[model samples]
Target: MKISKKKILELLTSGKYVPSTFKAIAKILEVKDKDDKKNLRKLLKELIEEGRIIRDSRGRYVIPGENMVIGDIQFTRRRFGAFVSRDDGEEVYIASDDTGFALDGDRVLVEITGTYRDLPKGCVVKVLKRGRTRIVGTFVTRGLFAFVIPDDPRIKYDFYVPPEGFNGAKPDEKVLLKITRYPSPGRNPEGVVDKVLGNAMDPAVDLPTVIFKHNLPEPGYFPEEVLKEAVKVAKPPTKKEISKRKDYRKDRIFTIDGEDAKDYDDAISIKKLKNGNYLLGVHIADVSHYVREGSALDREAYERGTSVYLLDTVIPMLPFELSNGICSLVEGEDRLTLSLEMEIDPGGKVVDFKVHEGVIRSVRRLTYTEVNRFLNGDNDPDLLKHLEPVKKELLVARELARILRDWRKKRGSVMDISSREVKILFDEKGRVVDILPQERGESEIMIEEFMIKANETIAEIFNTQDIPFVYRIHEKPDPESIIQLKHYLEAIGMKLRIPKNIHPKVLQEILEKTKDHPLHSSIERILVRSMKRAVYSERNIGHFGLASQAYTHFTSPIRRYPDLIVHRLLKKIIEKGHFSPEEIDRYEKELPRIAQHCSKRERIANEAEWDLLDMKKVEYISYHIGEIFDSVITGVTKFGLFVEIPEKMLSGLVHVSTLDDYYEYNETQNILVGKHKKRVFRIGDGVKVRAVHADKTTMEVDFVIVEKENNKNNKRNNSKNKAKKRKKKRRS
Candidate 1:
């Protein structure tokens, strides 16, 4: 068996001294073929390179006991930078000295010098390897001296660039630079500008800045070979293909999506059976049909992992030829799809189900707005009497959607909603003209509800067949995070009402209470943030958000790679009936790694999206500096209360030191209590503020609390707030 990296580290720490001789190690390892010097040399070289085994003064190997072990480098940005020693998927603090020469994200060998209680602390004695090649930053100049200030605060060191070394760029330009010379002695990290995009304040540069910062793969079209393969979709599921599977093309099915949606991945059909049961068919685009395994297109899709839609632009996984054409379930087009046909009883219970590959013909491509308008009593050319049958069935679908939603929630689904979205409106130059709220309505929710049912049903079917499938699992919130959340809510004058079992039902009652209140959005926002992010995994852990017993992503295989994996697994199961024990072992072993990769890719996507949104928000508020507004405290720290404005809904700090009263921070309550006046400003409290400064370089919109009196006597308070805001802006 091939040993894991952790196992290698474990062997190094087992004994105080490991024999220097290869023969001794081979004997200890119980290898009968002792004369195989090549393999033994390879092992020795690997160990030395990894810093597991070290050669002492006279060439004797020594395993440095429990004090030394190799682990990944991690950095946490606090007042005093703390590099992690052993996170083990949890936070474990280590000092900067512990990091030694190990770069961020690098796997290194460290000597565990000490421990504070149960917390493992270490000092890196060796550098195993380097980590990243790219660095994202903006160039700044002071006289003749120039430096590249990193956008990521976690990057502890700045880059020093000589005037000529910048390679043809003026000061204050946002550039993608490569680390040419790492820090040595008192010098900072030095680099040369690899690509100069534009000025830091240029609106067009922000998207590229976001892309570079997250280390997301550059958005590029698939290669010629991949495009050729992707474009080659089987003409139309032939007579032979139809004979091997079920046929749903003649079924009165239709797709509902956004007005601008190009790739329609899912379609739904509903009909009344003679047995007094409803037949519901959930049809999905068979993307795996054309993008076969081990192809160039497949590899690119795997690398991308999922489609990334940023504002109006989409970085699609598969080329447009496949994603928007052959694989898209367009209206009146014959497309191959994986269909889930289920017989639903009057009570919304799925009595019987079958999964099959089939040909589908979508009768119409209906937009949510069009359907919702019709449902809400409005006439349209597409639905003015000619679409009466489709419209009536749409209402029936909504009713069925309600039944499914109720059933899922009753089973244990946490259905929560929040009003937090950036609706993009771009001008002719692709510059953002406006960023509004993306309103969620009943029609969208109906589609979501049906999709959830389809996914859960497929998960159950694969489970029953003993097939290996990728499940969209969301584990419970971290115990520490949950505890912190509970305390935070309590401090805000509310309680979680969590029960002993720790289920979504604990939050259900709370959700129902604040359905449409002003603070409703904020409450849901906090709750959602408190929960862990959902990720793709082969293991089936029930979904916490959906509150489902079983869940898998089967609806959008065209965008999501995990869904494609699931689709392939289902097809295999359909043909072979079950997965072999060996195949199960392989999947079990590989799943953890797959989950890790998918999670990382998902983070990249989120970061890219959020970074762009933050830039846009910053730009949106840049014009409103010095404007006054009403606000409420959304966050509290020792430094100040973070006040969020009501109009634009942007958050800025109201420093405690600037409150015109001496204050002390209360750790337990997350508040700053004024000493003399006894004035208390805490999280969730109301406060008025005025925007004093908005710095584009820092992307910070600063605000000072609007005190009733700001005369000559209050000069110190105004100065303090101004000074604090300026300091933060400069640092950022």
Candidate 2:
């Protein structure tokens, strides 16, 4: 059932005094069935006594006015704040002096005293909940009771630690802190150091740990419990089980991925029909065989929801013993797989398809680079000898991929340039040795195209079946961001005439023209970020960015939990032929929470990746703090200009006050105009700057614009302004 605005208002008006009960009210309003209705009502009584909601003495619902609105926080580096009030679709402006104690990303309740563009401006009257207790910080020993300050500057406070709380940690070591005392009602939150990482500079171990701290379950080096469970579970494709399904192990098949890939979730086998249609088997590893519902491993995988890749390291959802060993499709070994077999002609259309359970033996493990080299007619003897058949299939697959890519691009898909991982080679002491971009060759594209094809096809399959499963859907950008981006581009005397609704094709054409145009990379980034975040949801919203009629994450179940759920849901309806509508409804009600959880955790993983890259960049810059570099002004704000050093991905700030002249920001044009010197700096303009400081404690790099003549001219203009001001004051 669709949510009714009247029913929600009634619950809000009813006296509920607790936060948990407010959550219950949300759930009650969302559910369609009779069973879910009972649980929500049971919790309503507890909410009445918690003062979270007030009941007038006359006995009627009197929810706090602040409780009426909820919004996602928009965090800044400053102690100041503003929340994007989703309830009212406005920026809730917060004064720097009024922050009190709330920090970034903390959800809180506020009173909507002012509405700006239908959004609210209000003080955070209460913190509804603390998202997490664990935070990463570095220790400092001063006295018998030392403290640890969080590496995340937004935390605003340090932890107080006794010797025992150090857990064998020494001074200046990086450690994890567990909040022991929260700033309750009116107090500041304090924590005790719980775990000590060996050193502050050890990147190998700490990088993965930071990835785990975000409540994402990591595939441990050795998790014996899950390993044991995986080992005991039998594949049991006995005669009886095999008889119920089709077996296609004899078809020549192969898997193509990165050279370092351990978990092979998808494989391809191809054959040409008499009428020129192609039968392509997109066999995926049947992960559901090993991971059963409610099992220990399943529970852990559910919690993690996706694999996190930080540079060369992988924090997988399943234990390596399973992901890399049992489930991995090794060459020459028979493995169970769930497949989408498709029949398409040379025109690159998916005319017909079937989803089946089967067995397959991969003939070889092929690398993407080798396939690319072969395709370019620059093959070595080894590639020709070993990967010839695979390349043949890839040629046919690429034709299909080309068709698919064109079809989507023509349909308004927002295309993205290939961004490889910035591989940083480090010395034993964690010092950067070299930095280079990872090569994404032909094999990668072919595999990606195939996986996308399978995902979209199965997404339609699920939509037609009416089964509830999580989909990776991208929404359109908010109006504010689009306007901001337009202004930024116009400041450089260029403008993209994007459609008001911003369909994918317009952006794709702009990207195609802007390729390799000096400011291309940064402008592309703005376009990419101008869209709403892609997340998992049960609804088939029709992925705006991908420009697909239906889309999902069907492949890579070994890495992503939503894909695993998709596989299971698809299998139940496709193979089993019948399923409980009630159960799907249950999933429809439940999967949104998991989808929200997975999306948030994915962001945390991304943050960890950027954190590692930035730490490496900081380490890379420690040696060059005083050196000058040529940079492009990628961003300009009231506070500073962000100059991107293209040779290195390090961005530094040229503070507003350091400009040597009085300047005012022109928000409409994304430029800072010097009042006296009359110089202007905006996004995409080239500027030279000298590094002034690199503060590791704050992860801030300060720069001074390096034109001496410009500075001298500005100083002379400033003196003239000062003299004029004095004359006016004297006359007055």
Off by over 4 Å in 1: 1-97, 101-103, 108-129, 183-187, 232-239, 274-276, 380-389, 427-433, 464-467, 499-501, 646-649, 675-678, 696-699, 707-725, 728-732
lDDT score for residue 654 of model 2: 80
Candidate 2 on 1-732: residue-level lDDT in tens?
A: 544444544667656523334345556567746655654444444343333443333444446664345444545555555663342223576555444456566655555567555355666655544556777777887767687777775556666776667777788777788878755445556677777765765555457446534544544643577778877874444667556666876777888777678888889987778998888789988888788988988987877777888766788888876688767887887777888998877766789999987777788887776677777787688768887656667677766667666766777777656563677888887677767767576557667767777888888877887767778888777778787667766766676786677767877887887776677778788887787778787777878778877888878888888888887887778756766878767896778777776776677678777776777776666667556689999889997799988777678788786676899998777789999999888788888876665544456666767775355555444433443443344223
TM-score of each: 0.85, 0.82
Give lDDT per model, in order: 0.72, 0.70
Per-residue lDDT over 479-536 for candidate 1, one digit per residue giving the tens place of the 0 to 100 score:
5655665776777777556654577776666678667544555667677777888877
Measured by TM-score, the strongest candidate is 1
Q: Which ten residues in a row have the lowest lDDT in candidate 2?
A: 723-732
TM-score for candidate 2, please give it. 0.82
